[model samples]
Target: MLQRLAFILLAGMLGLAALLVLGIGFDRLSKVRQLDRLPITQLNALNDGIYATSGRVASDAGSLTAPYSQDSVVFVRYLLEEEYTNSKGERKVRTLDSGSSATDFSLVDGTGRAVVSLGLQISQVDWQIRQTHRQQNGSRIYTEHSLRAGDLVEILAHFDRSRQRFELPDRVAGLNAIVSHSSLKIEGGKSLLIAGLWISCATGLLAVGLAALLVGLGIHRYWVFVLVMTLGLMAVLWTIGLVQLKKDWQIAADLYGRRSAAVAAAPANPAALADLYAYYLMIERSASQWPDSLLFRMAAPYSFRVPTLPQDAQNRVRNRLAEVQSSRFAEQNWVLFVVAACWLLTGLLIHFALRAIRFKRLVEFIPTSKTTGLAYGISELFGMIEVDDRYPPLLSSVNQQKCVAYQYRIEEKRGSGKKARWVTLDEGGASTVFWLKDALGRVAVNPAGAKLIFPEKKVSHEGKIRRTESWLPPFRSIYCLGMAGIADAEASRLSLQNSADFGMLITTQTEQEVVRGQGALGFLLTGLALATSLLAGTVWLAGAGSLTPLDLLQVSLLVPLTLALITSILHYNGLVFLKNRVDKTRADIATLLQRRHDLWPQLLVTVQTFLAHEQDLQTALRAVRDGQTGASGQPQNIAGQLAHERQVMARLEAYPTLKGNELVQTFVAQMTRNEDELALIRTGYNNAVELYNNQIEQLPDLILAKSFGFSAAPMWQG
Candidate 1:
């Protein structure tokens, strides 16, 4: 039973595989055929035909046309005279030499002319003798015109030469001739057989899919069956693709040959439309040769004689044709084909290989544990909670605590799976875990407090709790608090750092920032450098005639190089200046941070000391006056000035006896406000400095500075 089942499974799989392979092969073949359509190939052919015909006509015309002739006359022609009916139904006959030989003639249109001369050469003929016709309801008209000495010709030729007449023929004739004379019909039919094999292979792909499914269901020994079927299908598709390609190649080659003949026979005078057609033919021939030759080389088991031009002027022709030959073979179609084929094969192989494996053990091993009671169900019910406040409820629960009952509700899902799981509670709830339950009726664990039960699984909460004395560390928070007061000092320091007077490193940092557009200083340096470089170049060139080659090289090279070096030095100096300024700014900020740190601790002490002597007139006055004495003494004494103003205010408020003394209190109040304003100005300066420093360090400006050999400034530090 097992063996039978395996066989059946294998057969189905092979059938499906065959179908898929054949389908893909045919699809590819169809695409190839579509791509080979007349428009694309023929358009290319037309261009080549024009070029080749022009060359031949020009070559024949020799110096008469020389440069212009090579480009002017597109094709050569030979005329064949015969009587034909005109558009008015009148029969006319005219004798004229097409300039080549007789015998290359063929019947063309059934118009007034018996044979139409078609090529660039036909344009050489006088227009009076040709017929005219209107097409598309008179939208366009074709007329015969006379050729002048310098006029251009574009037409194909027809021959009337006797024994040599049939020497070379148009593409269509060439194909007919080959078919009639050769016995390759049987071989050609083999392509049809190959196509059939492809169809069969495609059928097998479908079979493979079916077999794989059966194997997954426990059929034994199916793999061996799959392997044999797959291999056979692949072989068949390969053969089909190959054979079809060969057949197409032969067809293209035959078409190309006929076109070449037509171009060769084209008329030289009165360049006709036929000449363009002939030129198009030549292009097709050249194109066809590439694929045919390539495939023949690759597929042929034995050495074959490669086609060659006829012996009369073969060497000269080959040499002359070298450029065209090279260009033609380098076309992209063949490369595209090879790439497409490789991709197709790779995809097919991967697909079939995967199907063949049919491994289901991995899937079968997955676990599905069920939670007991309503615990899981209730948990799921509580999982739906809205991240946004407005949403419908999924479930509701109540839990009692002390004298209050907390009400909770589950809302819509916030997200998916574990991430989505959530629960919401009414405003009065003390704990969310008490009322929640899973589908299995077990109590749901509260993730926030459950960590105590499983301590190892709990996230660490070390950083959360802390003494409330301060929210941030002293140095870090002081900058934020005293920004206004310190900013001006920082800006002044930064400016000094960018100045060239500070020497190379600081100046260079500044220049780099300017170049990088990080600071105003860099911009100034960049402009100066550009102007200097230009000036140097101009100066070097001005003395050009007076200098020898060596002298010119020395002078010119030195000018630019020297200027660049100077610029680099200047840039370096700017950076150093900027660094120095940054350092100074850092110092100022450090001082402010230190004062803030010290001030915070002294807040209670200062307040208590000032308030203790509040009622003692002499002591309070002495304290206020002594604080004022040292307030303005130091340049960096903002803290002292503030302390002094505080003491004076405390003295007045406590004394009341001093309230009527407006002058002293007023002076102290004004000083306090002035200090605050100065602090704000300093903050603004610091921010500006930070912005300038940051700008110099960013993109574009940074890139510019680096290009100019400018280095970055150090961060302001004290």
Candidate 2:
């Protein structure tokens, strides 16, 4: 009965937290809507409300030097942190310094320039990292984000015509503010990445956790219950670990926001107070909206580990850690130490598992391209391995089968009876440079830094010895996902290799098979994690005596429900991601459409330069300029732009002289490129809408969508 009551209480807490997270997601979606409604405007032709403008950063005032890198820049913010493992074996990190420097700068587009004052609190700047380095400690590094001269940046900010400066609007606490890169992509609220983690871990772990919960409940063993409770404990600590993980960025942001807020408050302006909060979100929002681990972020850039300060001052700033004390009589909680070890192991497993899941999703998200159609950036290809005939093929050590790549293990039986185990006699693998071939073409593949998971496996027994082998035989179908770049430019062959931008993965298994294999491995690791947690609890319980069913009931109800709520946030976050994608694409389309209107004069002048008839040109221009709103009810007048392009084409055809005219041809080609780009953006917007609608229509997510009144996003009919 006591356990039942605990469940009820924890349920309330879970529900409350869920509601809070849901509220944040909903609020972000609303803000995205507002920003989406606004059009991108040039600085020279500024409007009064929220809009995005792209321009080169320039300022008359002398630039400030970046603290560590010493680069002269208009604005710079940096954070320095040190990380080391503590006596408890827990990862510990401390912030040394973090701050921002800014000055009034002008955003210069060819049309004109607009003054962007640092006078406000909310400098919602997604300052790109200017300089960085790996520290001597090799753990914590500081990043310097800045706005340097000649930076072509897009700023989504409110331009208060009355104030003649860009500032956060007083009406909303959240800025619809997003830099183009903010995918700054304002990426719907908290990053969808977090939502994705919540969803994947929530759904993945919840399913696995419940299965483990069932096994525990069925066994009804006190030790078993202890294991579940132990995991619950680690779950809490894992959160603390994550917090410690993001602390540097968080601290720096907070410090900047607080100091900026204090200064902004002196003027008694609403926008000033609003900006204080906005800067806090810049780092968080600037993250890519993808379903990946938060722990997988790039290490901060370089900063000197040793301070230039005197020894005494340095000692004062960097306090020496307390020495770990030894005591024979002191009672040590073995559970803490044991769980820490298990947690670390579990973390590594989770990281590997998450990578598999990420790759699986990438396979689903990005369509496989023909070899000839591969882009220079991240690409996926389907093909068969074609050996480089110049070199002899790698022969499998076990079976002596001719192969392109192979791994074999030869093991001998050791010991006897209950202690008998397999002792490896020898194990090795070999990879030869090869080509991936499809119907269209083939590309060279370098196997350096690749994680190869082959499909075929064989285990053979001979007396007391056993041999196991897996290999990608020549002509077998293969799936290659990696960074595609130039290998031999003159030969016109592309090379597949690992780069900092994307990971390299080579698999003989099909995409579906690879995904399933990853799922199974993740499940096995999760089960092992449960086993360790249980072992930890059992070890601790050996000294502490027993547990009751009531205890199991009390703890089980609270942890799973909370974990469920935490993880299930994926759908909502996915919705936010989709919404942001749509918004970003919409803004882009609007910019192109506006360019069409802006470029008509150039097109008209080019035509008039050689030909006659001003009346026809003016008439076509007016038709194209008739701004018609799209289905989304935004000011993106796609119809008018379409009419203008159609008119340009029809008018051009009327004159034979304009067909091959150099300037006329250039304008025509530019218009064609614009049309193609606009088509792609429209397609992207529609895709986002479809995903959004599908998410809201799914189970449980549908309930949340209804609660939040998140209706289906309209497709681009424009």
Q: Best candidate, lDDT-wise?
A: 2
Model 1 spans with C-alpha error above 4 angstroms: 1-237, 249-312, 325-365, 368-718
Give lDDT per model, in order: 0.31, 0.54
| Index of the highest-TM-score prediction | 2
> What is residue 207's positional error in candidate 1, in angstroms?
14
TM-score for each candidate, following the candidate numbering: 0.21, 0.37
Residues 224-334 of candidate 2: C-alpha lDDT, one tens digit per residue:
433554475446434432343344334333334333434343555333333333332233332322211242244222210111334564343224211211111112364
Error of 1 at 10 (Å): 22
Worst 10 residues of 2 by lDDT: 321-330
lDDT digits (tens) for residues 567-599 of candidate 1: 344334444444454454445444544433333
RMSD of each: 26.9, 31.6
Q: Each candidate: how many clashes?
A: 141, 9
